[model samples]
Target: MSAYSASPSTPRTTSRTPTPPRTTVVNVEEFEMDGRSIETKSADHVPIVFKANPFKHTYPILRHTCFGVQGKQTCEVRDTTTNPMFRDMEEDDPQIQYVAKPFRSKSVQKPYRLRCGVMNYAWGKQSTDSAVAQWMQEGDPTYQVEQRPYAELWVGTHTNAPSYMQESTGSSSNLVSENSSFANQSLHEFLQRNPATLGDAHTEQFGTDLPYLLKILSVATALSIQAHPEKSHAERLHASDPDHYPDPNHKPEAVVALSNYKAMCSFRPLPEIAHHLQTIDELRALVHEDMVERFVTVVGSDGSSVEAKKEALKSIYMELLLCDSARVQQSIDAMTARLRNSTDLSWVESTFLDLTVQYPGDGGCFQVFFLNLIELKPGEGLFLAANEPHAYIHGDAVEIMARSDNVVRAGLTPKFKDHKVMGEMLSYDTQPLHIFRPNNEGPLTSYCPPPEYPDFKLLRVSLTEEWPGVSYELGKSSGCLLVTQGSATLLYCGKDCTIPTARLEVSVGSAYFLPSRLSVYFSRMTDFVAFIGECQIRAG
Candidate 1:
């Protein structure tokens, strides 16, 4: 049993290379099909072959079923071609005898190479400055870094920007295309045909596709201040206006910083907001005097329930969001002008001025005072639940979310704004954003979310010279892996008590689609760091 196995109860071994299966020998004569005669010295080496039908290219010419004979210690091979698509197939056929052995199914799941899509949004970091671009370039030699900004690298089966699986052929791998029988296929299409890859629990809950979308973001400027709708609200929005809503799925996302990162997330704590409201005269000027006084009074009251505080916060936020654009702009101009010459300024005040310069007169500038201004060092993370407003300010990060693109933007973007929806959809929870720290378990650092969010969880693998290897049990969920640094060799062992069936060299920016119910071993050649996004399987 390997020490890195997921559990002691499930003992498994690992090897640098695969062990060949034992074989039995039997004698057989040469067989001919479509004028092609294949000879074997003994039946032990005769291979089962399928030839493509010329007329019906989609269907194969022959199908064989082999069963072991008890007394003879050999196998009887029979043709079971019953498809109506095959023309002139004979029912009476001679059975060929051969040595029986364990047969592997063609439908068995294996790791697949992926070609992810890149988004070049204006807020993205430019070319080589962008981690998204650098990773994409490393994974794909064909990708060229242009002068344009590269914002995100999306890895999922979303129809908006689906990832394509590359088919390995001999020494080269090619992107699966429509013309090939099954070589080039979108991740969504492939999952439709092989739902088992998603695991039974995930497939039962989320259907054929992945419930989560993984992304690598490179932020040079601020993203739009936005909130995602809840499931029911998303369905309604998609039904009424799909042009903006796109998909009928809610997005609850989390981001793990890869560099020094900054963002505005959720609502500030009641006391914090109360303090800001009391001190920032310019922010207080945007909302009505009555609303501001009511918010401060409610927050300061010890008898107030959490629900009461939430209502108070919501009222204040809605007042600010619904304020006239001219009035909001006037307040922002006053605040920025006053803070410009101040020698001492709080982080929040500095962020407000920066946003003002980027998006002058935008209402999101005022939002800084209302939301928690969070700064995350590398590996630190925060979850933004559905209906919670957030906007990435700067830096690089890897993010995972419930598969959705439904964003209701209010400000700081040239994109369409839905101030009414944004105001109504916000949860207005005033708890300070909780920073997630990965729980270290050997070489694996797990960032598992609370049980309420069962869509996805992230695992970070760090391999150093001191601890050069690790094994991960895929259990009952499919996962996507992105190698962000250094190099390693992967040994893929599917199911339990099985030797590795495949071995591949992986390096920085290499990405793979790992199938469900497999154990994968990684041996580091150099320091390695990779992130795996898998469906969260709750334990009973």
Candidate 2:
């Protein structure tokens, strides 16, 4: 079922009953850009489409040399290698990387529809159960649901999953056939050619990359128990293990629930850990008696140094994690049997029994004791630190993370588990349960992420005809915007806001790459909502 297909609060632009295609287009939505309301008489712009060429084939499509909206119509034709944004993106002091040659093509920028990639990782949801799949279903008639697990919809450029814009010439979404693939160049490639579009701020801070990677994660089963290394550690690990670590960037991420979202994040609080360690015989039986005694003693003691307490926790966790694999399985079996026979129930007990079935005999079944369980209802959000051990248990969420794939596994996965590296990298510091809320108020809400990972930020923008417009000052960098509600239009300009650019109609499931360095005001919209992901580049 499409979660955003219909809601009482959301306004629909389509007709009540479906009919055959009409040649003429109707301009029903109003526009408010640059603070002035303009009546849209027509939508003369053509809808762009791209088709996949089955056999290895390349097409000569138009390339816009410009990055920002201002420069899209023209290009100064700067070399990408010398573009400072291209040079500074990675901290390794490399001159430039990832960008392919044939730098800038000679063509004017015309609006193109973005076509992102689909990730079918094993843990993903299947059929109608996938939010990623459902979002892809938007405006796509040829999208068919296969029985395979559809895990994530990648909306950024990270090599593993990069979105592409429509480069080929085509009519409307209706006219696009299966053979026509929309992706001509990866968004990363486009950014390399036009760094200005990302704006001065992002280019100066993170260079060519849009510091964050946005994804729609639809989980049918629990993800692997994992922790991402910090920047320095990431560089070291990547140097050691390039196959898995891939990028030297840290992966501090945030998740906004699309549906009821469940996850196991970080380690459990000390008090909770003590209670379970003492009460849960299954845990006590597995860890070293001395280590267990030490943890209980410190936690039981009144005054202990932060380092002392952390060290105690580290000892207990390592004992549990590195315990004999067979004994670990045995203890888990014991817990499951106890859970099945016992009448008393608890969240951990139930969760344990459930996940055990998903990943039978895995040590993570016992490792659950060392983690915090979190549930986020729709609209709720939370940030996950790079050092936090987290596993997405189930449910759907829109996730944004630093553009890195450097995950060190602990357990709960069929993939290789780097237990030693995970132990070294995991943050044992306990934290109280945290739920993210919009820090900035008004028509556009901003959920500020933690300072540790300042590469990316998120914004929730809402619009309506009555409150038709909301304005945001232009920053050095632009953002990646995804519309989740009603249709609307956006315009960017200076403070006087008199002269506006062409009205860009934003509809449901619509995604746009906003150029940097322009204040934007949205109008001609009602009950509209959207999420914007961008790099957090500070003004010097």
Candidate 3:
């Protein structure tokens, strides 16, 4: 039987008619980059349906290139002209890396989105009030840019910049930051005064230290093996090299697998790495005998020379990172050929080959075999703590971490490659492979797990049949809930609100903050994943 029944008879004793389901109404205000309020009249300049996803096969067709095609206009050019903000964006801009899509690989098994921050660029380009009119009514009337994107896809939120909407897009809520200070008022305005659950409150509380972080990852290739710095290393580096390093904040993160996830975790035992490093027949000829001997000496039988081995590896990494790409590729190719033929190749050897193919010239390709290989089934996850090193291989995962955007790159990237700095800042201490797991310790234990970073916690909420009817409470922590699968209704304010699974319906991008006092219920087709995290503020 349905949960809410129809009442044929009127409300007799109370003399009050049952309240009909109320329509969801979101109030989005306009603002400039400098944080000034603008009138809704300016919305014509920045139409709600500003731009759609640039990918071709995806719904709400995306514009990839800088040029506008026959029917579709290129968002790059449109963004440049319409929202002149891109000119100010530099590589060092906190928002750039803050919202960067770090997934890049050649063996991606499924479709993934890229450049979630691109939406922010769209928003920065023009106020919705001004751009909307130009894209829509200025054209052939009906042929305006009015199609909304999917909520699952990247749009706008505090984590990342909101993509300007050309049309009414997602099945979920639309996210917009009216003023610079993202507060409960904005949450109230976005969700239309609905009371949030405790989980919602927890996710909504991302404070001022680090306000937002979001990404839409597509794994076209397998990623290299790597991990991020803990708060200590990050702080030290930030203090040491203020110009080049990351902000000194904890980086505890969560990844919601958008597709099948494949990655490499920490290094295998020293014996394992040494054993594999020795068995390579072809590699023996490619590398110098002296270098090979050094590796053997460092990897003794007892594994007693741990510090020596680490130092040797540090030296080798420096040499390789400093060496020309051609030289490195030659060694990689030789190893690949040898591993391809040998059945006895060690796990590390095989991993090297896999990453080499995924990232041809990346130095990270060489480091793959030293780490643990983790293959995440759809909806499965692997978390990493501070100092725990890990690199994403292939597939799109919704990543939620602390507000700080400090990343010291080691390898497997075209953007930034700083081995010296990374080496100094990285935690070489060995640890277990399973970083993300259920917290057996805590007061608010409801499948919501706190990340390695004390500042943040990530909860993976998938509505299963077991949760046929689950009511998620909003804890004291403000939080954001990003739906990754299926459609569901959020029961709030004494009524049920339907949240569609379609991308266009959930255009609010990666964040949906719920306050502490409110609670919400979910009822939908099973198998929906949400990346819930604490927001930066608290409502007194």
- By TM-score, the best candidate is 1
Task: Give per-residue CA lDDT, model 1, range 1-540, as digits (tens).
Answer: 112522112222222211112212233322333422221211332122222223222212222322221011112122224333224333353322121222344544567877788899999999999999899888767888999999999999877778887755444222211223445689889889978777887777778889899999999999999999989999999999999999898898889988899999898778888888889898888888888899889988999988899888888888887889899888887888899989999888889989999998888888887788888987788887889999999999999998999999988998899888898888888665767875454567777677788888888887775556667768878899888888887766564323345567777776778878766777777988889998777664
What does candidate 3 score in Cα RMSD to the true structure? Answer: 20.8
lDDT (10s digit) by residue, model 2, range 228-342: 9889999998898899889898898888887889899888879889988889898899887787788988987888888899889887787777888889888888888889998
For model 3, residues 275-355, the per-residue Cα lDDT tens digits are: 656765534443566776787777674664667777766565455456667777777777677678988866556667767
**Residue 2, candidate 1: alpha-carbon lDDT:** 19
**Candidate 1 runs further than 4 Å off:** 1-108, 169-181, 538-540
**Ranking 1 against 2 by TM-score, winner:** 1
- How does each model score on lDDT? 0.73, 0.66, 0.44
Q: Kindly report which residue stretches of model 3 are placed more than 4 angstroms away from their true locations once superposed.
A: 1-216, 223-227, 232-250, 281-320, 323-326, 337-354, 435-452, 493-511, 525-527, 535-540
Displacement of residue 108 (Cα, Å) in model 1 is: 5.1
**Which consecutive 10 residues in model 2 have the weakest lDDT in total?**
1-10
Query: What lDDT would candidate 2 get against the real structure?
Result: 0.66
Candidates sorted by lDDT, best first: 1, 2, 3
Choose 1 or 3, whichever is better by lDDT.
1
Candidate 3 lowest-lDDT run of ten:
32-41
Error of 3 at 182 (Å): 10
